[model samples]
Structures are given as structure tokens and as C-alpha cells.
Target: MSAYDAVLARQSWSKLTQEAPTREELLPLVAAAGRVADHSSLQPWRLIELRGDDRLRLGAAIAEANGDLKPSSKPLRASLLIAVVVSFRPSEKVPRWEQEAVASGVAHVLSLLLDEAGWGVIWRTGGHTRTAAVAAAHGLTENEELLGWLYVGGKPDGKRPGRRKPVDAESLLTRLPSAEGIAG
Candidate 1:
């Protein structure tokens, strides 16, 4: 499919199978997604892939962070979880917020690539994402922040739910007012 069609067709797949893309299959997509617009090529983002026991560790950490008595099965929702981290870089021109946006863009682009590659993907985040326990579980450093995780697996075989509503482009699009109107 064309890039435009792929983008428009992309939707979050919450229910996914246990099958996931192998590391070899993922590296190329990651590289392509990393081509997102960066002000100074700071590359302020990194991804950590989690599977098996790693997911269990993250689930436990999430439970602890939420003060729950039992471990959470959230991380086990998919066979693979890619943790998105914004690694802040000290730059006189690029501010922290811009860097964070770059990181977020990378994640979104990666999701699109994954979707195009026939993988079910969803970006998941919560209030506990930045908690100490969760950060420790991901081994986040002082300069890094947890953006979220992309849960990935094979798309289940069946018809999905209703299609997404079309965006109201006309209502959303606008141009600046004329100079006379602005002055008035």
C-alpha cells in the first residue's frame, strides 16, 4: 500500500497474538523510523525491547508502583514491548520540550512502520509511567524519561471493529485573516 494509505489505515490493535517480529525484522524498521525530523540530529530517543521474563519484571514493577498487592499483567498483553525513552541531550538551541517531541515522533513513526509490516501495534502509557519503580525497572537514567511502550504482536485473524471516523479536514484547516480584517 502507498504510504498515505498505510497511514490512514493504521489503527491501534489492543488484542494481539503471541507472535511478534523477530529482532532481525525489527532493526530495519527502527532504522527507517529513526529518520524522523530532528533539529540537530540529536537522536534523543532509544527503544528497549522486552519479552518473556523482562515483561514479568516490568509487570511487577508496575504493580509495585501502583501500590497493588498483586503483580500487573499489563506488560504481558503482548509478546513484545518496546519501551520508548527520551534521552535528553544538553543543547543550547534545542530545548527539552522539542527533544521530547522528536522522541515522540519517532515512536509514532515506528508504530506506522510496524502497522504497515502487518504487525499489530499499540502505544500504551499511564500515570505510573514515570514513577520511580517503573523507571528503575527500565533502567532509566537521570537524563532519560519514559515516554511509553509499544505493544507489538501478530494481528488476530478476524474482522476488526468499526472503522475510524473520517477527520473533518475543512473544519480543522484555516488560513490567517486578511491584513484589514486583522487590523479591524
Candidate 2:
């Protein structure tokens, strides 16, 4: 499919199955995702893929952080869980939020790449997800921040694609300098 076609076809699929790409298969897709529009070439993002029991451990940490005694496998339902982390580099040129924006862009691009590869993906985040406990669970240092988890798996045949509300593009788009100014 063309790049534009892939972008249009990409939809967040939460109702995924246990079928996922192996580490070997995922490496190339990840590398492509990393080729994003990074300002200053700081490369401020990192992904930690969690498979098998690691998901359960993360779920447990999430539960604990939320004051729950039992862990919820809700987040672990997917075959692979990737923790999208923003690693801060002490840069004089780039600000922290800008670095985080780059990291966020990388995650979004990765999700699109996964969609193109016929895998379902969703970026999930909540109060518990960004907590100190969860960060520590994922081995994030003080300089690193846990952005969210990208839940990935094969899309079930009958599963519905994520809801997309109609957006008015004209309302969101704007041309700088009014026609009156130009004519003046």
C-alpha cells in the first residue's frame, strides 16, 4: 500500500488477539519508526517491549500504584506491550517538552508502522501508568519519563476499528495574514 493509503487505513485497534510479531520481525518496523522528524537529532525516545510474563508484572505494579490488591490483566490482554519512554538528554538547544514531543511522535509513528504491517495497536495511558511506581517497574531512571504503553496484537476478524468522529478540517486549518492585509 502507498504511504498515504497506509496512513488512512491506520486505526487504533484495542480488541486484539494473542498473535503478535516476533522480536526478529519487529526490529525492522521499530527501526523505521525511529526514523522520525527529530529536532536537533537528540533521539530522545526509547521503547521497551514487554512480552509474556513481563506484562503481568507491569499490571501488578500498575495495580499496586492504584491501591488495588489484585492485578488487572486488562492492560496485559495484548500479545506485546511496549513502554514508550522519554529519555531526557541535557541539551542546551532543545527543551524538555520538545524532546518529549519527539518521543511522542516516535510512538505514534511506530503505531502507524504496526498498522501498516497488519497488526492492531493502541497507545494507552492513565493515572497509574505515569506514576513513580510504574516508572520504577519499567526500569526508568529519574531522567526518564514513562509516556504510555503501546498495546499491540493481531486484529480479530470481527473486531471493530476504533471510533473516528468526523472532523471539520477547515475549522482547524488557518491561513496566516488575512486577505485584507495582503490586498492592503
Candidate 3:
């Protein structure tokens, strides 16, 4: 499929099966994601593929982090879960926030590719995102952050439509003082 088609057709798939992305497949996906707009080539992030026992450890961490909710409830559902991590290395040229944005951009593109490849993808983040134990499990230092959990699996034969609305072009664009600006 074309790149545009992949971008447009990509959807957040939550209800997925046990089949997941293989290590070989994931390497290419991560490479594509690393091609995102990272300012100054800081390369300020990393990703950890969590599966099998790692997923169990993550689920336990989640359950411990959240008292009321059962972490085991939905943690091990996927055959592979990629933990999208953002690292801050004290850059004078790039702000820490922007580095985080680059990581998110990579995650977005990776999700799109996974969807196009027939694997259901879900980007998840919660209280565990900011927890110290979870952060340490993935070797994220104090300046680093856990952006999200990218869950991958086989798409169910029948799935619900994604929650999306058509973009209001007029509301999204304005006549900025630029040569390519679209007048209001």
C-alpha cells in the first residue's frame, strides 16, 4: 500500500488477538519511527520491547502502581508490547519538551505502519507512565519519561469503528503572514 494510504488507513486498534509483531518486523518499524523529525540529531529516546515474562512484570508493576484497578486485567493481552521511552540528556540546543515530542512522533508513525501491516495497534499510557519502578524497569533515568505503551496483535475479524471525526479545515487553518499562507 502507498504511504498516504497507510497514514490515512491507520487506526487505533484496542481489541486485538494474541498474534503479535515479530522481532524482525519490529526492527524495521522502529527504524522507520527513528526517521521522525528529531531536531539536531539528538536521538533523544529509546524503545524497549516487552513480552512474556517482561509483560508479566509490567502488569504487576501497573497493579502495584494503581491500587483499585487490576493491572493484570489487560496487561498481558498482547503478544508484544513496545514501551516507547523518552530520554532527556540535558541539551542546550533542544528543549526537553521537544525531545519528548520527537519520541511521540516516532510512536505515531510506528503505530501507523503496524496498522497497515494488519496488526492491531494501541498506544496506551496511564499512572504507570510516571512511576519510578516502571521507569527503572526499562532503564530510564530521572530525566527520562515513559511516553506510552504500543500494544501489537492480530486484528480481530470484526471490530468497532474508531472514534474519529472529520477535521474542520477552516477552523484548522488561518492566514498567517507567510508567502504560502491561505487567506481567510
Instruction: Name the best candidate (by lDDT).
Output: 1
lDDT of each: 0.94, 0.89, 0.83
Task: For residues 24-86, write the lDDT of model 1, one tens digit per residue.
Answer: 999999999999999999999999999999999999999999999899999999999999999
Model 2 off-target regions past 4 Å? 177-184
Question: For model 3, how does the per-residue alpha-carbon lDDT over 1-184 read when each residue is reduced to its tens digit?
Answer: 9998887777777788899888998888789879999899888889899988898888777777666455665668788899988887778899989999998998899898888878888899887789876776777887789997998899888776367677698989966677556455
Query: 1 or 3, which is superior by lDDT?
Result: 1
Tens digit of lDDT per residue, candidate 2, span 1-184? Answer: 9988888788888789999999998899889988898888999989999998898889898888988999978766797999999999989999999999999999998999899888999999887767877988899988899989899999999889899777688999977988789995
- TM-score winner between candidates 1 and 2: 1
**TM-score ranking from best to worst?**
1, 2, 3
What's the best-to-worst order under lDDT? 1, 2, 3
**What would you estimate as the lDDT of candidate 1?**
0.94
Clashing residue pairs, backbone N/CA/C < 3 A, model 1: none
Alpha-carbon error at 184 in model 3, in Å? 21
Model 2: weakest 10-residue lDDT segment is 127-136
